[model samples]
Target: MSDVIVVGAGLAGLCCARELADHGLDVLVLERGDAPGGRLRTDEVNGFLLDRGFQVLLTAYPEARRALDYERLGLRPFYAGALVRHHGGFARVADPLRHPLGAARNLRAGPGSLVDKLRVARLRRRLSRASLNEVLEAPQVSMAEALRLEGFSREIVDGFFRPYLGGIFLDPALETSSRLFAYVFKLFAQGEAALPAAGMQAIPRQLAESLPKGAVRLAATVEAVDRGGVTLAGGERLEAGAVVVATDGPEAARLTGAVETPAARATTCMYFSAERSPLGEPILVLDGEGRGPVNDLCVPSDVAPSYAPPGAALISATILGIPPLDDDGLEAVVLEQLRRWFGAQVDGWRRLAVYRIPFALPAQPPAVLALPQRPVRLRDGLFVCGDHRDTASIQGAMVSGRRAAAALRGSDSGPSCAL
Candidate 1:
C-alpha cells in the first residue's frame, strides 16, 4: 500500500502527490482521463493547437510562480490590453503604463470617457499596492456592485468591462464575487497573461513528469473512496494510508460527501484555421457592443507561432454560455458574427472544432468568497482540494493541493489505513 492515494490527476491532485512524495511519502495518483491537466487539456487538428477552452495563465499567480517553471513552459504573452469592437469599428485600449502614448492617443477613441479612463488608472494603482490577501479580504459584494462603487461609468462597464471580465469569470452579468474581481484585476496589473508555446497541457505534463515513475496511473477511475483506500471502476481496491479527493467540485462532493458542490458556469469555444489572422497582433478582441454570441476572440497563432503551421493562423472564439443550438447552427451564428466584425475575409476561415464545456468553472458569487480558502482537511486521513475549495483559477487549484498536503503531513501520527 502506498503512503497516500490522491484520486484525480489534475493540478490539485498532481500538486498534492508531488508535495507528499517530496516529503518522503509514497504517493499514487489515479486519474480518470487518459492524460493529466483535467480541464487544461489541448488537442491538435489540421496542424493547429486548440485548448479545451479559452484559458490563459497569469504570470503573477503566487502559487503558479512557486510551482511552475515558466522558462520550461516557454510562455507566450498577450498584449497588455484588448481591442474593443465599438460603433462600426475596433478601438484600442492599451495599458497606460505599458503603452502610455497609445493610451493617451486612444483616450477618446474607445468605449468610455476620459474620466472613466482615469478611474481605471486609479483602480489599477490602488489594487496594485494592495497584497493578494488584502484584495481577497476586502468587502464581499457582486462584481457589478463593486464596479459601481468604484465610480465607473455605465458606458465603460457595458462596452469594456462586461465583455473583458465577463469572458474571464464566465459571468457576463458580472455577478461573480468582488473579491475574485479584485484579485484578478491585481494580477493582470502586476503581470502579463500568457500561454505555453506547447499548449496549456504542458503545465500538468511538467508536474506529472516530475513525479517518480509510475506515480500517476492514467485511465484509472476511482468508483469509491474511503479514509482507508479507493475502489477502482473494475472492482480492484487499492489501499493507502490516506486519501485526497481532488476531482472537480461535483465529483469530489459525490465521493466524499463533505464538499459543497458549486454551480457550474458553462462555455463554448470554437477554433478556426485561416490563411492569415484578422488582427495581426497578439491582442484579444472583445465584443464591446454586446451585439453577438462571440464574447471574446483571439488569434492564438499570433501569440504563439507554434500554435499553427507556417502560413496558417489559428483563431479562437469564446461564447459565454452554451446556446441551445446544434453544432451546425452554432457555427452559422458564430460565422455570421465574425463576418460582421472582419468582413468577407472571414469566409476563408475553416471551422476546426467546437468545444462545449458544461462545467468550465465553478460559479463564484459573494457567498463563495466569504471564505476564500475553504478547509482542505475533511477529517483525519481524508482531505479534499480543488479550484472549488478556493478561488476558481489555476492558482487556487494548486494552492488547495499544497494546503491538502500540508494538512496530511500535520496528521502523520494518525492511525495508518489504506487511503
Candidate 2:
C-alpha cells in the first residue's frame, strides 16, 4: 500500500503529490487521461502547436515561485496592450509600462464620455484597493448590482465587462461575484499575460517531472473510494494510507459525497492556419467586429515564435459557455465568425484543430464563496483538492494541492517546507 494515493493528475493533484513525495512520503497519482495537465493542454497539427484554447499564463500567479520554474520554462510574452474594437472604430488599450503616457492619452481622449471615463477610473481604483476575502465573506453580491451601485453606465458594462469578463468565466449573463474582480485586475495590473514557448502543457509536464519516475499512472480511471482504499474502473482495488481527490468540483463531490454543486461552464476554441495572416503583431484582438464565437483572437506566433510554421500564422478563436453536445456547432460558429473578420483569408486558411471543453471552468457562485476547502480527511485515509477548494485557476489548484499535503503531514515537526 502506498503512503498516499492522489486521485487525478491535474495541477492540484500533481502539486500535492510532489510536496508529499519530496518530504519522503510515498505518493502515487492516478489520472483518467494519458497526460497530467487538466485544462492546461496543447495539440499539434501540421507542425503547429495549439493550446486547447487561447490561454495566457499569468506571471503574477502566487504559487509559481514555489511550485514552478518560470525562468527555465521560457515563458514568452506578448505586448500587454490589447486592441479593442468598438462600434466602427478601434483603440489601443495600452499597459502601464509598455506605453504609460500613451495609455493616459487614450484613457483621457478615448470613446467614453467624460462621466463614463471618470466613473471607470474611480471604480478601478476602488476595486484595486478592496480585498477579495472581505467581499467574498461579507455578502454575495452580483457584478450587475455592484456596477449599478457604482454608477457605471449600461454602455460601459456592455462594451467592457460583457465580452471581456464573459470570455473569462464563459457567462454572458455576468452573474459572477465581484470578489473575482480582484484576481482579474491582478492579472492586468501585473502585466503578465504570456504563453510558454512550447505550449500550455509544458506547465503540468514541468510539475510532473518534479516527482519520481513512474509515480503517475495515466488512463487509470478511478471508480470508487472507501476508507480502506480506492477501486479502479475495471474492478481492480488498491490500498493506500490516504487518497487525495484532485478532480474538479463535481467530481470531488462524487468522490466524497459532499454537497452537490453545478459543473463548470465550458469553452469552444478553434484554430486556423493562414497563408497570409490578417492578424497583426499584437497578441490579443479583443471585441473585434464580428468576433462572435470568436470574442477574442490571438496570433500565438506573435507572442511565441515557435508556435507556428515559418510562413504560416496560428490564429486562435475563443468563445465561452459552450455545451458539450455542440461540438460541431461550436466549430461552425467559430469558423463563421472568423470569416466575418477576415473574408478572403478565411478562405485560404486551413483548419488546424478544434477543442471543445465541457468543463473548462467551475461556475463560482456566491454560495461557493463560503464553502470551505475540500475535506482533507474522509475517514482515516482520504482527502480532496482542486480549484474548487479555493480560487479556480492555476494558482488556486496548486495552492489547494499544497494545502492538502500539509494537512496529511499533520505536524509542524514533519518537514516545515512540506507544509
Candidate 3:
C-alpha cells in the first residue's frame, strides 16, 4: 500500500506526486500511456522529434516557471514580436522593449487603421494589471463580444486573434470566455514566449527525473478508481491513502465521477522537413484571411537548430477544428494546410511526423464558467486533480494537482481508515 496513489502520469499527476514525496509521503503514479508526459509529449520518428502539437511556454505562466526548472532545461527563447502574414505580404510586430523602432513602424503601417491600432495598445495596458480571480469570477463573455465592446474592428480581430490565439487553443470561433482572453492577454503582454532546446517534452521529463525511482508507473491503464483505491485494466487493485486523477478533462471526469463533456476544441499539427526555412525566427505567424486549413505556422528549427538535422528546417503547421481521429481524415487536412502555408516549398516535403489529439483542450465555453475547485473526496481516501478541475493549460494542470496534494496532506493528519 502506498501513502498516495496518483492516476495519470501527466504534468499534474507527476507534479503532485513530486510534491507529496518531497513532503515525506510515498507516492505511486499510474499512467495509462506507455510513458509519462501525457499531452506535453514528443515522439522521435524518422530523425525528427515530433511534439503532439506546436506548444510554447509563456514566460509569464506562474505555475510553470515556479514549479519546473526552466534553467536546467535550457529553453530557447522566441521573439516577443509576432509575424502577421496577410494575403499578399506579411508584417513583423517587434518586441516593444527590444525593437521600439520596429514596433512604432508596424503600429503606423500595420493593416489595422489608426483607431484600431490605438485601441490595441490601450487594451494591452489594461490587460497587464487584470487579476485572474476577477477574470475567472466575472460574468462569462465571449472573446469576440468582449473585443467588440472594447471598440475593436472586425478586421483587427480577424487579422490578429483568430489565427494567433485561435491556434493555441484550437478555437477559431473566438467564443471562449472573456476570462480566458484576459488571462491569455496578460500572458502575451508580460512575458516572452519560448521553447526548450530539446522540445516541449523536456520540461515534463525534467520534472519526472526529480522523483524517486518506481514512483511513476507507465502504460498502466486505469479501469476504475474508487475509495478502495485504483483498479488497473489488468484487474490489479492498489490501495492508497489518497488518489489523484490527473488525466485530461474528459478522462478525469470519467475516473472521478465528475463532468464528462466533449472537449471544447481539437488540435491538428503537421511536421514537414523542408530544406528551405519558411521564416527567419521561430516567431508565431498568423494568417489574417481567417479561412483555410493552415491558420498558423511556427518554425521550431529557427528557435532551436538542434530540433532538426543540419540544413533541414522543421515547419509546424497548425489547424483549428475537431477533425476525426482517423489518419485519412486528419492527415489530409493537415497536408492541405501545409501546402497552403508553404506553397511549393512544402511540395514533396519529407513527411517526418503528424499528430492529432482529439480532446486537446476543454471546450471552455461560457457554460464552463468555472470548474469545481474542491477536491473530490469520493471514497474514504480518494482525490482528483487535472485541468478538468481548473482552467485548461499546463499551468492549470500543475496547479490543480498541487491543490489536490494539499487537500490530501491535510486529510492524512486527521484520520486513516483501516480496511
Task: Give me the candidate number with maximum lDDT.
Answer: 1
Q: What stretches of model 1 exceed 4 Å from their correct place? A: 411-419
For residues 14-128, write the lDDT of model 3, one tens digit per residue: 8888889989999999888887899898877656667888888887777787787888777888877777766656777665656788788888654577788777778777766
Query: TM-score of predicted model 3?
Result: 0.92
C-alpha lDDT values of all predictions? 0.92, 0.74, 0.75
Model 2 lDDT per residue over 2-105, tens place: 98999999999999999999899999999999899988888878789999877877787767656788887799887766666677556666654566775777
Tens-place lDDT per residue, model 1, 173-212, is: 9999999998899899889999999989999999999999
Ordering by lDDT:
1, 3, 2
Candidate 3 residue pairs in clash (backbone atoms < 3 Å) = 264-362, 264-363
> Model 3 residue 177 lDDT?
74
- Candidate 2 lDDT at 130 equals 58
TM-scores for candidates 1 onward, in order: 0.97, 0.90, 0.92
Q: For candidate 2, which ten residues in a row score worst on lDDT?
A: 410-419
What residue runs in model 2 are displaced by over 4 Å at the alpha carbon? 108-111, 127-140, 288-291, 323-335, 371-375, 411-419
Provide the RMSD of all predictions against the true structure, rounded to 1 decimal: 3.4, 3.1, 4.1
Instruction: In model 2, state the lDDT of residue 303.
Output: 79
